[model samples]
Target: MTLRILILLGALSAFGPLAIDLYLPAFPALAQAFGTDIEHVQLTLAAYFVGLAIGQLIYGPLIDRFGRRGPLLIGVVLFSLSSLACALVPDLDWMVAARFIQALGGCVGMVAARTVVRDLCDPTTTAKVFSQLVLVMGVAPILAPVLGGVLLAAFGWPSMFIVLALFGSVCGLAVWRWLPETYPADMPRRPLGGALANYGRLLRDSSFVGNALAGGFAMGGMFAYIAGSPFVYIELYEVSTQHYAWLFGLNAAGFILLAQVNAALMRLRGPQFWLMRWVWVHFASGMALLAVALAQPAALWPLLLPLFCSIASLGCIMPNATACALARHGANAGSASALLGSLQFSIAAVTSAMVGALHDGSSVPLAGVIAVCALLALALTVWTASRD
Candidate 1:
């Protein structure tokens, strides 16, 4: 792919992560502003995940039927509008509602970007391209918190939403001008029933379902971290907002670095081989994380170390599993990508909400949730591989 294509796709994929991570540093401020607990503030993240999960199902058929560009433009415009709505919200409930609306629009970019990759590239090439996309997506987490911290310090949390609105507007304009419609206009448009049948067929495929579950559960652990870290780092560890952003950036850097390593390894080993191997690593790291949280909750390093390893492993697992799943159903790439994204975000949403709901003013909820997700992911991968 050309640099321009890579950049556009990367920017498109980064929108969700940017939206999620950018507001993290402001969580404490948001909770303060709304006279609510941190958990209630965290629900906003869960709301976004819920939007992403459901909205992809709606957009998948639309993209496949009408082609990619039209659905993408509509989604971005909606995202920008909802972002503005979020900025204008007067309370936590309205903020959560606005976030859901924002996610509904923002999720289109993720599904479309993955679908476009499948449309343009073979499976092997798709894995590499996804890794490249990860490199681009990595910038969001690294910059978002730092920028959010700065913005929160300067202009408060509402300014972050305004910036997101501007970002959505710019991305929408870029998609309009530059992103080529990968789905052919002449392609047959399937009826809604046909699209539902396609999803049902994908659900029945062991390889696709297995990889999707594996990826989704692995991502659930990451979402648990996202939901719990603000409390752990800020309240428990007493880190400053700037310091927390740096710590978050450090983990994100590891994730990006390992993603590049996965891309290089893809040149030498297949995605399945690496995916199976990393699932084991992810499981071990999760166990280690739980052990440390149980044994040394007071020491920050013990927990942070294992958490970093687990998240880094996820960076390897996601793109490979995604490529593997999409590779199996090239005939229905849009539906496949949509299902994959929906499952992942759904798992993430559940875990994030659970972490918040189960918050005990300690690290156990976070560590325990991560361990459970890892074991489940590992079991699914093993079961799927055994079936093969």
Candidate 2:
């Protein structure tokens, strides 16, 4: 892929992360403003994940039928409008609703970006391309929370939504002006019924299913971190909001850096080779995290270290596993990408909700859930490795 194309695709894929991470520092403020608890505000994040999970399924077939650009344009427009709605919401309920709508719009970019990669690149190159895209995508998480902290301290939480709206608008214009429709209109389009069948076929494919599950469970661990970190760092550790933002950014930086390392290692190793190694790393780090949390350590650094290591492992797993899954389905790249994304986000939504539901003023719930996700991912990896 050209640098220009990589940048554009990366930006498109980064929308979801930007939306999630940029407002994280404002969670306490949002709860206070709405006269609700932090957990209620957390439902907005869960709602966004739910929207992403379902919206991709809808867009997958539409993109295949209509081609990529049209659905992408519409999704960005919807995302922009919903972001505005979020900024203007009258209450927490409206905020949650608006976030769901925002996710519906934002997810089109994700599905379309992956489909376009499949359309343009061969399988070997796809893994490299995805790693490069992850590098580009990594910028949002690295900067978002810090920017959010500054904005939250100076302007307030609603300003974050305004920034998100502006981001969507800019990305929409970029897609319109630059992103070519990779899916040709003349391509054979699956009928709606056939599309559902396509999903069934994918599910039954042991390789695809295993890779998807492995990636999904790893992503679930990340979502658990996202959902529970604010409480763990700020409420439990008694960190300031500014410090919390930096801490969040620190973990994101580790993730980005390791992704670059994965890209480098991919030159010498197969994607699956690296994926297996990282899955083990993730499992080990997660176990260590659980050990620390269970012991009730007096200092926060013990927990933070393993937590950072676990999240960083995702930098290796996500791009490689996604490339592996999509590599198996060239003829139906859109559907394949959709199923992969939907499964990943669906897992994320469940993990996030579980974290919230299991919140008990302790770090054990988050650590326990993260450990389980990592273990499940490792099992999936081992099961699939033999097949490969």
Q: Can you tell me which runs of candidate 1 are displaced by over 4 Å?
A: 184-187
lDDT of 2 by residue, 1-388 (tens): 6788899999999989999999998999999999998888899999999999999999988888888899999999999999989999999999999999999999998999999999998876788788888889988988999999999999999999999999999999999998887875556877777888999999999889999999999999998999999899888899888888888888888888888888888789788898999999999999999999999887799998999999998988988898888887987888899989999999999999999999898899899999999999999999998998
Q: Candidate 2, 248: how far from true, in Å?
A: 1.0
Clashes of 1: 0
Cα lDDT, model 1, residue 273: 82
Number of colliding residue pairs in each model: 0, 0
Q: What is the C-alpha lDDT of each candidate?
A: 0.91, 0.91
Which lDDT tens digits does candidate 1 get at residues 1-388? Answer: 6788888889889889999999999998999999998889998999999999999998888877778899999999999999999989999999999999999999999999999999889988888889889999899999999999999999999999999999999999899898888874556765666888889998999989999999999999998999899999999889999999999999999899999999999889888888899999999999999988887466687788899999999889988989888987666778889999999999999999999888888898999999999999999988888887
Candidate 1 residue pairs in backbone clash: none
